[model samples]
Target chain A: MGDHDAPFDEPIDDPLAESLRRSLEPDPTLVPSAERVAAVRRAAERRAAEHDRNQNGPDSLRNAVSSRSLRPLIAAAALIVVGMFAALGLDRGPDGDVEYDGDIAGPGGDGTLRVVEIGIGRLVDLDTSDLAILPTGEYYELWFVGPDDTPDAPNRISAGTFHPDADGRSQVSFTAAVNPELLPTVEITAEPGDGDPRPSGVVVMSATIDR
Target chain B: MGGSSSRAARLDPTTLRQVVERARHHDPDAWESLYRHCYPALYAYAGRRLSPAVADDAVSDALARAIERIDRFEWRGAGFDAWMYGILRNVVKERYRHVTTQALPTDPAQLAQGLVEGEDASTALLARTEAAQIRRAFAALSESDQDLLELRVIAGLSAVETGQLLGKEAGAVRMAQARALDRLRAALRGGLDG
Candidate 1:
């Protein structure tokens, strides 16, 4: 409890005393996604390499060396990394989609849509924390390259894309009500950040509720 | 405040903050420990709010994100539990778009995730009843109250981060959260009685 001194409308000091705290709690175990980490590392390394090239090139290098400055670029890269991660942590509201902001490629689709075959193994993982959920606020958005549909398909303009965390792991399965495990759920394709609510991409991933 | 030293129980704020610090360093032990510590609670919270698969996805995704940002593990005298819990809440919210399409998600995933596994009808019924009660109680509160409760009880966020999520100061949140809880307690009590 805290000092109930500051605000006239402060919360009660003993807020949930009568309520039952979880007694026999389940273990908070996370299923690790190793494949994702590798992909993230690879991507990060690639970017780092490209950065190295750009900095060492005759023109940029001369500009930096002549003026004797490297901190700015370092700061810039740091900022970029922070920004990239910050993007990862974001779950954009209904209208934050940037159309073609940073979507690398389509997730899964046929030629008509340019679908990418996505799987748990396909995502890039970079977190050293061994956490199942990546640090990114969301997973990467996927696209159906063929005949697609978004969340509210026929209605919404675009298919819904489930973005991955920094490690690119997103939940695509739904739970059953009665049997909990008896019925299976469907999987939908990931949509781009197009600022649409309804999922408007082709159904790339799906599975019936596994009984 | 959480009362009674619960080991794997609701990780009091201090332990939670330490877990964040450990998880940040890629400490597999700490990572696993923290993951194991919060995942199920998150699962339950997500379950209450979403479908099973979506809940798992949210919990799993949250943990993955937690891994990446371990480097940003700012203790700030806050419990890692609340911080991580806050992340889980976002995961649930973000995944909602697709989850909405799924017809009936909670029951199946709840069973699958071993929430209310094979047991007597009474046991399952009781658990379901309690869950339903909680959900009903949760819905009765204001959106802000619901958010705070979910963050505190379900998400297990710290006072500071909880404030950050809702764009308020920790002290203000602490006060608001306590009041919110009082209101919730009243609501739950009334629901239980009336």
Candidate 2:
């Protein structure tokens, strides 16, 4: 069969195909409700605002001060504030709690994984927007892997197991008794229900802990 | 293809790409336009496999995820509709994992609407019967077959566009679609015989 280059090529002349098409035709009147559309728009706007804030954070302030004809005192004061914020580690959760954050991505999905040391153990918070849903009898497992980890001789500790919601968005928090300094790599894998306590090696997402 | 009012069908690829670009820059109007364009097909795809209520939530969730991940979206010439459908498909599959039973809408009158041009009573009745038959036959096919046909007939995606969403070669998709149609026809015949 020769593939057509056109994006939406019309179907061939077949009565069955035509009838199937008519039967499955989308109902024109079945539009999304205005409220639903508004909700989506609100979500988009919120994400946009967050993105803008991230993009225009400390670097943007430094650039604005240096590029403009500002007074020396104001520029120096702005720089000092930026420096203080950076030095204080504003992203840390609380006093004596070291936080590590990184992006986890692989084919068909991506997410953010955050680890925080809460004195007793580590807390992992995973937020994925587009992870594929595993079939029944299978689930996704999170692992904190050490530097010497390998496929054959895997050196890792399980944080938890979870399945994404119907929306393929998973926001989960799990507490594990491990240290981020020892297990600096985080991994997510699709594991079968075989009861085998081993890394399946089917890594869907992985990232190094960025301190 | 004949009577589809899907906004995606109305938008040319160039205009759609422009709108997607604007949405990438976080333009509210652009996102609105994109949502309207893709909503019809996305709803149809989800509604076919899910209950009406779940379908609505699935579409909303797909759009929400699209907004969050729009920054990472790259243009590959399949247009934004395919991209939105890709997300919706994943959402639908996730829903399927949780659901042991699907609530497919099989109302003959509802399925028959707009299938025929004339408003005549007899024609409408015939349309309803035929539509019911088609729906039954369509449902009897394997899930993979139904998915292919849904992409081709319902979503109005070309083989190439379906391939892009499914991560398959265009020729392979075309061949598979033909095979799927054959299976559907066989299923229809089996239904009639039964």
Candidate 3:
């Protein structure tokens, strides 16, 4: 009850969602051109490298030395944790939870896409709708082809990573402990295909999964 | 089935890693592959966050950082995208602070609770009317309110990290978030209802 009242209890959306529909309709005028987008990307990569060098200076190379040494400690702890968890009666949950994500494009808004994975639990949901039994450690990440932002600049929202059902297809399912209504659209990067519950290295596939 | 084969033609994470590893070792072919693969999205993220001029700088900086850093890349479960994002987040956050001329979002929830979810039906409806309208309205918000709303609700940054990035005292981010949210409610309701 800050300055405004809570709408959650109201449970009333725009009468017919006419406004929501109109709001979603894309505007051709605002769309980023391909040429402009490509130029920005080329420039950004050049700049990222330059900035890193300037900030880190020559000492940057040596800095990784420490990070590398600490890696083992992290890995060791992870391993011990894994071992202990395994030894305990700790039981893993059902293996059927599938995750998915995609992008949501609204004209003239942030022009930024969001994390829209639907099948996994990190930043998204475990769509129990379809129980096809997907594995852990392997999931998807989203990426776009042109400039990341609509108006200008380039940026990639992780769009989240999730476990895909073995069958790899299902109904619309999304549960977000975060913001649910404004969930981003999703695409499958196919970064991982295992049951390990993590994103694989490469983006294999992506689709603009819309609502 | 042919679609699957065609898709396989595109690099997956393992293949992308191999490409990066080759590039790290000075393999021109691998370098070319790496550039071809990551250039699009990385470039896109930068362009949107910064001006074209600064974007060029940021992108090149990230790449160079990767070159020097590529060796150190452990290729843990986290892929280059995750690693790159970690670096890019800093770049965007730095620019956000500079351009907006504001201190850290003392109250982070103001962004998420307010900007994204307005309690007033009329206000939420208005914000959802047009992305631009919302953006312009968003721009008018006070410095703290803007930051909190952008990172938490709009940009969807984590509350704890939003606090760290905004530079409020420890635990202040949370309390601030509550207050910030209140501010947002006021702004949206005030802006829209009126």
Best by lDDT: 2
The worst-scoring run of ten residues by lDDT in candidate 1 chain A lies at A105-114
Ranking by DockQ: 2, 1, 3
Model 3 captures what fraction of native contacts?
Answer: 0.01
| Fnat per model, in the order shown | 0.05, 0.37, 0.01
TM-score of chain A of each: 0.21, 0.59, 0.22
Model 2, runs deviating above 4 Å: A1-14, A61-211, B1-10, B100-119
Candidate 1: stretches off by over 4 Å: A1-17, A20-211, B1-30, B101-132, B153-161, B178-194
Best by TM-score: 2
Which tens-of-lDDT digit does each residue in A1-211 have in candidate 1? 1111212232334524323234213334433244433433344344446555765797776677557377777788988898976777543322232112111211121111111112221121111111122123322232222223334333111123334344324433211122212212233433333555444332333323222
- In order, the Cα lDDT scores of the candidates are 0.46, 0.73, 0.41
Local accuracy of candidate 1 as per-residue lDDT tens digits, B33-141: 5654565566666665666666666766777666655555554433455556656766665566346523332363453454543566557666656655555666677
Question: For candidate 3, lDDT tens digit of each residue in B1-194?
Answer: 00111111225756776776775654545544554444444444454345545655555555545554565555432345444544444445443325422222223344334454346755765454444334434445565555444444433234443433343322454566556555544565676686
State the DockQ of every prediction: 0.07, 0.30, 0.03
Better candidate by lDDT, 1 or 2: 2
RMSD of each: 18.3, 7.7, 22.6
Model 1: residue A163 alpha-carbon error in angstroms: 18
